[model samples]
Target: MKTIQLFFLILIIVSCSSNKKISVNTSKQSLKNQQLIIDTDINTENIIVEEISANTEIRLKKDSITTVNSYITAPVFDSILKPKHDSFNKLLSMFVSKEGFVHYKDLKKRQLDLQKYIFYLGENLPTQNWTKSDILAFWINTYNALTIDLILRHYPVKSIKDIKNPWQQRHWKLGDKWYNLDEIEHQILRKMDEPRLHFAIVCASISCPKLLNEAYTAENLEQQLTNATQDFLSDSTKNSISKDKVELSKIFNWFNADFTKNGSLIDFLNLYSPIEISKTASKSFKDYNWDLNE
Candidate 1:
């Protein structure tokens, strides 16, 4: 009996040890599962934060694009300067009065309009094969358009030089750069170096050439520019060619440096002037009229 009892006790002790080992293993497995759950939760949180950040960046970019689209350029001419058919004439009309005067509220207002419209035109200008006349027409329109803008806001002065260091002011802001009226005239337009520009652009005064009632077209641009130059020279009040001395408008004197760059004013004039005149003729300056060119 004692031996039987001993064997049974030993068996009970072994069974208890086995149960303890099983409990330990179950506890370890439960801990591991808890840790995995915690790690999964952390990963989920990180993904949410990344998604939120991405959404915020997208919203900001969209807002920036919207602001850019709202911008416009200074419209000095409407249907009168650019053909309305499939063009931006309607948008151009927003910046000018029916009589062709820019609204002089402030620089910011003008800048907003100018920025918007220039971009619009640049984006929408025809891109197919174009003739020199087409290119010239666009340039002339741009020059006159910009000139009218400068005059409407500021005029009645003796000369464009009368402005008090206005060149420093940010007139036309484009592509992260600011351009003054002088740069537009001398650099961009004159660099093309076309003489017809002299007659196409106006300074908003009677002495300057008349602003064409219609926009210049590529088909007739060359003829138009030539006609403009001829008409201005023929007008006795503006320019008169004589055998001895060549009497000319103040424009020749003011912009004499431009003409004189390649050759003398007499030479430049002789290229277009029909009447015969000597190169050694006496050079005289004419007074400019400041009367409003209505």
Candidate 2:
């Protein structure tokens, strides 16, 4: 009976696949009107910004092929596809400052655009062929973007923590899964095993690592992660690092295990600290300020 069920499952999948005919018509004219984000490192061809109708199949050209029916159609199953972060990058380049502080007032003025891009993320997730780097980059962006949107929703506030359940509020649906910041951080991201990610996904706080102004692409993920880690360690305001003594942000203390996966916490700090850290250096964690990063 088990063998018969397995045979039927395979037969059903093959039959469903054989019945579907997919045809993609790229409108080069419409695509030409879509401005590529100037600073993004993603392939220009990866983004398709046409105003597609719900009846049309949305086929985006990224690392893999993804077919989506529409907002009304059931989301694609069994895969998490890479998202097009060009529009979100453009917005980030505009509203985020050199120091990583957000111009929340000005960003709030364009909340609709932000919401639209987020909805696109919901409709088109990363698929099987997307590199892990690409997928990780997508979620990092999603977490940051949603955090910003959350701040915008309750703008004019003092801190993100002031808003009720800032991290726990379920704001958007990505495919079939509804995600809050907590789930994305602990469940999806931390499990990826890249400790550098601790510095990339900000919580909209003053002490959090400055959100990268541009999107993370598969081509630039390694360097971006390295840059984020290095910048976070070297920032005097966040981590006061020296060869003999180190006073780090509370992030180091809270997520110590993450940074120590490969070796001791000092070993990880030495990788990015400008000066080599002594294993026996005095260590302390700074108070975390929850003030809004803006």
- TM-scores, each model vs. reference: 0.53, 0.74
Which pairs of residues collide in model 2? 80-126, 80-127, 81-125, 81-126, 81-127, 82-126
lDDT of 1 by residue, 251-289 (tens): 887777777878877887876777766878886766777
- For every candidate in turn, the CA RMSD to the true structure comes to 15.7, 21.0
What is candidate 1's CA lDDT for residue 138? Answer: 70
How accurate locally is residue 170 in candidate 1, as Cα lDDT from 0 to 100? Answer: 48
Best prediction by lDDT: 2
Q: Which candidate is the best by TM-score?
A: 2
List candidate 2 stretches off by more than 4 Å: 1-81
What is the TM-score (0 to 1) of candidate 2?
A: 0.74
The per-model lDDT (C-alpha) reads 0.61, 0.82
What is the overall TM-score of model 1 with all chains considered together?
0.53
Worst 10 residues of 1 by lDDT: 65-74
Give stretches of model 1 more than 4 Å off.
Answer: 1-119, 122-132, 154-178, 260-263
State the lDDT at 3 in candidate 2: 100
